[model samples]
Target: MTSKPLISVIVAVYNGAKTLQHCIDSVSNQTYLNKELIIIDGGSTDGTIEIIKSNQDKITYWESEPDNGIYHAWNKALGHASGDWICFLGSDDYLWKSSVFEEIIPHMIKAESQGTRMVYGQVARVTEDEEICCLDGDSWEYTWRGIIIDGIGSFAHQGMFHHRSIFELYGMFDVSFKIVGDYELLIRVFKEGGNAIFVNGLIVTGMQIGGITSNCVKLVNEMARARRKNRLRVITIPWLISYAWAICFPFLNYIIGERYVRYLVNFGKSSVTYLSYKKNVILEHKNDQ
Candidate 1:
């Protein structure tokens, strides 16, 4: 019988006392048996250390210290991870269910057989109250278009599983990118012809909203930098339009507030939906001829 592969779950946190326990519990509660948990704290002053101490028995290895950023902390954690597959979760993020790891194991096994290096699933963006906002993630087949056209990629890091060999091949995350280092690393993977598999109907993690990713302006700037760094074009129409909107979003939010901004977003989505429906109808008519 083949032994189940060991998986490592790594978390990096700073001043995350309020939510760190949930993150730890989610990993500890996983039904998968062959796994290890590692955590790196950024010298948090908010009782996060106490939480880590209490959960020491469940963690394989952990340390609390000041670090440069999430990527630096992640790079640090990578050294301690001794698993065939590695997954990263934010201090505020939690696995979607106890069966998440169990469910993903088969996919991981299949990926290994096929020489794929990455496997990812959907993530639910949730509010503090646990209300789900939406599912985030897409098929890798469609992911490249957005990465190339918008100068950004959309895979949720919390929901991704990286084969250990990927780091061995591609190196660790770039510590310089304060916001989009994960995206940059992912871009490097795809640019170098790394293969990925996306499992449908698998919701791996529940990500809390209003994290660093909510800073749209900084995210957009870093995304452009990442694209350039990876030798991807940064002058596409979608990229330009997103850059313009990101620059203006803060001012618009300041003047009109988030509610109105949400309204405008919904309106734009509606317009796009209508246009897409009309285009589909025209295509159908032409095809019928």
Candidate 2:
């Protein structure tokens, strides 16, 4: 019998004592056999270290120390990973089910056969109360356009699996990006013609909202910077409008009140969705030819 490929699940956290155990439990309880869990803690003063100590037997590797940012912790964890495939999970994120890895293994094999270095599925974006806001993720073509033209990443990074060769070829995440390092890394790979396969039937992860990625101003700024760093144009109409909206949102919320601002935001989103639908039609036609 052929051995199952090893998968390394890395979690980078800082002062996330409350949700850390749930995250660890989700990974540790995976039905898949060939997997390792690595945790990198950024010197938490909270009870996070104690939780790590408690779960030491289940964890393959763990370290607690001050770090620059999420990407820095992720980069440090990368050095310790010994898996055929790697995935990053947030302390507030958890696998959707115990059987998720078991289910995804076949897709991983398919991706490997096709020379696709990245495989991503959907993630449930949930409120703090665990009510799901929406399912996040899309096809690679849409994701590519979202990252390149819209200054946004349509997929959740938590839902992604990276082949070992991706790191070997493209290097690691850029620590310079505070809010959008994951976006920058994806942009870097896709720009260089790296292939990604989308797993349509699975929702791989459940992520709680209101993380650092929720900071609108920081996220948009870092996204624009990431596009520029990846040698992609950031002055596209969609990006310019997104930047303007991010810059004005706080003031608009304060002046017009958040309720009305949300109404305006929703209207804007509807318009963007229509535009995206139109663009997708064009892309589909091009693909058919």
Candidate 3:
């Protein structure tokens, strides 16, 4: 990527009139110079398409007809994308900041230049009241632990920005699964041994503290599907240990959902402590200098 690489930021929207403007401005106001915004709307009846059309000039490419679901809409957006790397910013959610990609894209290019096949990043949760919280910033060392164990996390159409080749190699979002496509996609990518890199930076912020996914029951169901997909995804699990896990872990979450929440809460709390320690260390180094 010699010249500036164009980042194709795809947005999948469905009746998001309230946050539609926020989502649009978030991408449009991005400090990144070379980029394109593709929005896939699911035939919204609430004037969402009108609002999106009003700013059609700003949209690189878009379609406002009904789609199967979020991942299908995302796939449509991807098909329309014409950039070296593709990232997703959904209608319900927006980027953490206008300059996030500006700061991260160069790092991606550098990583790719280093012969890395792809990179995995992190995401934050935008609570119902609009509180922006980082998944990995607070005591959350193993942010992807849920993904590692139950096969789901804050990743979805968010938390990652990978090269076009990744989708080509692993294939696009699995439309068969509704709520678990993102988890399924990530599991496949990881199992494929894609050049994955972890960045502490905050990526997209999920805006659904009050939504279905924000709730516990729906989330567990989603996880179960994701786990099943993972088992089917990999040719075989490593030895009987993982094979047994692949069979039983999905059901374990139901018994331990409350425990899982407690663990994540503590994990998030601990991340805050670690962040403070690192910040103080940097400041101490500067003061000594």
**Please, what are the lDDT tens digits per residue for candidate 2 over residues 206-232?**
998667865677888888889888788
lDDT of 3 by residue, 158-238 (tens): 656768887888899988877667777767766534345566655654554334443444544565667676774222222
After superposing candidate 2 on the true structure, give the runs of residues whose Cα lies further than 4 Å from its correct spot: 1-3, 248-277, 280-289
Query: Model 1 shows how many backbone clashes?
Result: 0
Best by TM-score: 2
TM-score of each predicted structure versus truth: 0.87, 0.89, 0.73
Report, for every candidate in turn, its global Cα lDDT versus the true structure. Answer: 0.82, 0.83, 0.64
Q: How many Å off is the CA of 100 in candidate 2?
A: 0.7
Superior candidate under lDDT, 1 versus 3: 1
Q: Name the candidate, 1 or 2, with the larger TM-score value.
A: 2
